[model samples]
Every structure is written in C-alpha cells, then in structure tokens.
Target: MKQRHEVFFKQLEGMRNYLLKVADVTEEEAQIVPKGFKNNIRWNLGHVFVEQYAWIENLTKEEVDFPKHFNEWFGWGTSPDDFTAETPSLEELKPLLKEQIANIKGTYGDRLEEVFEPTQGMDTLEQVLLWTTFHEGMHLQTILDIKKVYECLIEN
Candidate 1:
C-alpha cells in the first residue's frame, strides 16, 4: 500500500509537470476564456496548484500558508465568475505551479501513508490518493479543451 502511494505520487508529479509545460506554450490572453463556462487554463492551473496546499493542510493538520483569497478565488463554492478574468502571466504562474508540485512531492508524498479521516466516501489512503488524481486529471483535460478553444478563437 505504501509502495502504491509512492507510485501514485510519482505519476501525479509527472502529470502536473506535463500540465505546466503545456502552459508555457499557451498565450496569456488565451488563458482567459470569456464567453465560456470554464475558467481557462490559467485559472484551472492555479486552482489545482492552490488545492495542493488546501488538501495537504486538511489531511495533515499542518499549516501551509497558502495564498490569501485562494479560497475565494478557487474554492469549489465560488464560481470563476466571482473574480475577473485577470490571471498572472505564464512566467509568474509557471513557477507557482512548479513550486506547488515540489511541495506536494517533497512534503506530502510519503505522508499519505498516515490515516486520513474519511470524507466524501473516501475511506482509505488509497481512495484519497486516487480521488486527488482524478480531480487533477479532470482539470488537465479542461486545460486541453480550453487550449483548443483558444486556438480556434485566435485562428478565427
């Protein structure tokens, strides 16, 4: 079980790195989708980056000192429309994304072996690990979808 946790973190880290690399090629304005429901790649990316801290702190009962207003900006209770489409430049957000992945991989990777109080039907460490990846994977797909729309907008 511990070994599986280790493997999942590795895979999670790889997926996160891939998403960050994709952001490098995305245009800044293209990172904001106005007429659509989704919050563009930047917001989705930032949301996930922020979630590392949120989830870790929730599970580990430790202080993470995450960005202020992150909850308001990215919390599930708050819609993307709650804030303007303003987002940091790729240069800015890129490091944040990388830093977040580093923090999770370095600080919280092994910590997953500890028991997590069940929430939302996740009863074991494996379930929480898998659910986190599932959440991330959904946004990764959102990034790709937003990228396609961004390209179409530019070409048109």
Candidate 2:
C-alpha cells in the first residue's frame, strides 16, 4: 500500500470506532422527531457506509453489494429526506460496516497502483485518499451533532 493509502486506512479505522461509540449512545435513545436537518442515527450510519462504499466502487469498479434500499436511502446523489423509509437499527448496521471495511482492505490493498486515475481535478491516488479521509471526517462531525440531538431528546 502507498503511504497515503496507509494513512487513510488508519484515519478511517479511527473514525469508524468513534462513530460506533457515538451510535451506542444514540441508539439507546432512539426517538422519532417531526423535523430536523440531521438524519437519525440509523441514516447517519448507513450514510457513512454507503459513502465509503461509493468511493471504493468508484476507484475499483467492484460492486459493493449493499442492499437495494441503501442506494435509494443513502446513495451518492440523495440527501436524508429523499426517502420516506424507516432507518435500520444500529445493530443491523454493524455487520455491514465490518464487511465493507474488509472488502475495501482486500480489494485495494494490492491494487493501489492500478486502481485510481487522476481525473479532472484530482491528479493522483493520494489526492483521492485525502478526499476520502476528509469525507469521513465531515460525517464524523455530523454524527456528533446527531448524537447531541439524541441526548437532548432523551433529556426532554
């Protein structure tokens, strides 16, 4: 693996752990709110998985094989309210997260040199890795905010 890929994997693992910790709390207080900018805990988790899956698929051209609904619920071009379907429980998401991470490691670990191409703006795999890390970090903050709402709802 390249240095950039290695660093991205480390960062991804850290963020995944952090998000799970936050989900543990949020899942305990699951409540339906009438309105909000943030998606619920389940939506947030699925979003993380699907986004990573999207990036991996884009680079490797491998099918991620996530459930069909996930594509509509949290796919590349949609936002939280795009679908009216209920979100899955956090317990339901843990396995998928593990599987996705394993698939990414397996497929990309050896194929780094051949996997990515410099596109219109990005000129290297390192740039793609950096973008992916930033994407995960952005969602980490969103997860934190969602956790705060969960806490407030529980307290009220």
Candidate 3:
C-alpha cells in the first residue's frame, strides 16, 4: 500500500502552488531586494527547495545534496545581495522549485514509514517530511511578504 503520508505531499503541493504564485515574475523582478528585506522572491524559491533537501540528506545521513551552487546561493545565512554572476534566474528557479516537490513525492510517497536508520528520535521519514512541510510553509509566508514589498517598491 502507498505510504500513509500522502497528505504530506498534498500539503507540499498547496505550498508549492502558493510559492509559485508569489515567485512568478521576471528575473529582474525576482532580483529586487525591497527596502527592509535582505532577500527577494528568487532567493526564497531556491531556499524552499534547498532547505528541504538539506534536512533529508543531513538528518538521514544520506549523501544526497542539492546542486553545489544551491548552498552558495540559497543556503541559510545567504542574502540576495550576495548574488554572483552565476546566480540562477527566476526562470531557472521556478521550475526547479516545482521539481523539488515532485521529486520528494516520488522518493518518499511510498517510503515515509521506512526507517531512516541514522535517526533515533524524530528520525523517521515521516518526521522529515513533516518538518520539511513546516519549513516550506514558513517560506511561503515569507515569499508572500517579500512579493508584496517588492511590488510596492516597483509601483512607487
């Protein structure tokens, strides 16, 4: 039978849809750092993907990592002003954000109850999925706030 945590993917899908709605914009738009904000929509988009993957890989003692550049560009403590020539455009990040969700679904949908041997407390696949969902939800709200500020700045 399919893993019981299908609801987790459903929640992620809702979060993904909301994040896409906020992150949908030109590369130039996604690059804007609103007056009080350190990062923009693009950073949050990449972050939502990176942090989830980071938790799974780290907590499970798995070797999987996001692309090398993801840590540099979107890792915690990263800021939008740190952009280098190699920073991904919103166009690039948008699809990858969705792909992250789809990849998680494919990887964990049937295996959520499978033991993540490295974890002793809250180490189950279900807990990882749960934590990732909460993290994504937080980022979704942050993206919404950033988008509003960015849009306001654009207008005035």
Candidate 4:
C-alpha cells in the first residue's frame, strides 16, 4: 500500500474507533429518540454503515455486502419511525464498523487513485472515500449530541 493510502486507512480506523466509543450507550439508550431529534444513536450508526457501502458501490459499480434491510432502516431520508423490522443493535453495528476499515483497505487500498466515470462529481475512489469519511463525521456529531441528551434525561 502507498504511504498516503496507509495514512488514510489509519485515519479511518481512528475515526471509527472514536465513533464507537462515543456510542457506548445501552440498547435502550440507543433507541431513545431524544426530543427535538429526528433519530437516535442506533439510527445514526446504521446510516453511517449503510451510507459507506452505498457510496463504495456507486464508485465501483459493484455490490457491497451489508446486513439485510439496512438501506430501508437507515438510508438517507429514512427514520426509525419508518422501520418495518428490528434493526441491528450497537453490539452488531460496532463489530461491523470495526471490520469495515479493514475490508475497505483490503478491497480498494490499491485502487484509491483509479479513476472512474464521475459519480456525484467524484471521479476517483479516494474522493468518494473522503466524502464518506466526512459523512461519517457528520453522523458522529449527531451521535454525540444524542448521547448528551440521553445523559441529561437520565440526570433529570
């Protein structure tokens, strides 16, 4: 792997670890849609997982493996209120998130600079991966906010 690609992978792994740490709440807490929030910790977790796969699929034109119903449960514009079935718990999601960086590196580490027809204005796999990282960061902030709300609620 190139040095830059190694750095990118390490950054991704670090960010994912931090996100998992921030999500250290009970399953019940993960399900709590704090007042004024559109979704809960669980929803944000699932969305990040699904969104990464969706972006990679768009770039590679290849299907990526993820749990069934993840798209319906967590896709963009989806809400927990719309879920028709039970979704993965934090326990399930954490392992998937932990493994995702390794999988991404193994699958695309050497292909980062490879160019493809533009998707969402991104022509390189690296560009799409950067965008996905930004997307994950945004949802990580949401999870932190939700965690704060849950903590306050418990204190009250």
Please identify which of the two predictions, 1 or 4, would achieve the higher lDDT against the true structure: 4
| Cα lDDT computed for each candidate against the true fold | 0.67, 0.64, 0.77, 0.88
Candidate 4 local distance difference test against the native: 0.88
Of 2 and 4, the candidate ahead on lDDT is: 4
Sort the candidates on TM-score, descending order: 4, 3, 1, 2
Q: Give the number of the best model, judged by TM-score.
A: 4
Off by over 4 Å in 2: 1-7, 26-38, 77-87, 123-126
> Model 1, 35-131: lDDT tens per residue?
6655766677767767656666666566886675766766665555666545454566678777765566566666665676756665444456567
Location of the lowest summed lDDT over 10 successive residues in candidate 2: 25-34
Q: Model 1: how far is 116 from its true place, Å? A: 2.7
lDDT of 2 by residue, 1-156 (tens): 678677777776776776677667445543333256545566666777877766656665567676767878777666646656365666877777756655666766655556355453664444555676677677667767766765686689
lDDT of 4 by residue, 64-89 (tens): 87774788888999988876646777
Which candidate would rank higher by TM-score, 1 or 2?
A: 1
lDDT of 3 by residue, 30-140 (tens): 777777777888888888778888888877677664696788889999987777889888888877887887787786677677776654366677788678778878887
Compared with the true structure, the alpha-carbon lDDT of candidate 2 equals 0.64
In the predicted model 1, the residue pairs found to clash are none
TM-score for each of the candidates:
0.78, 0.73, 0.86, 0.95
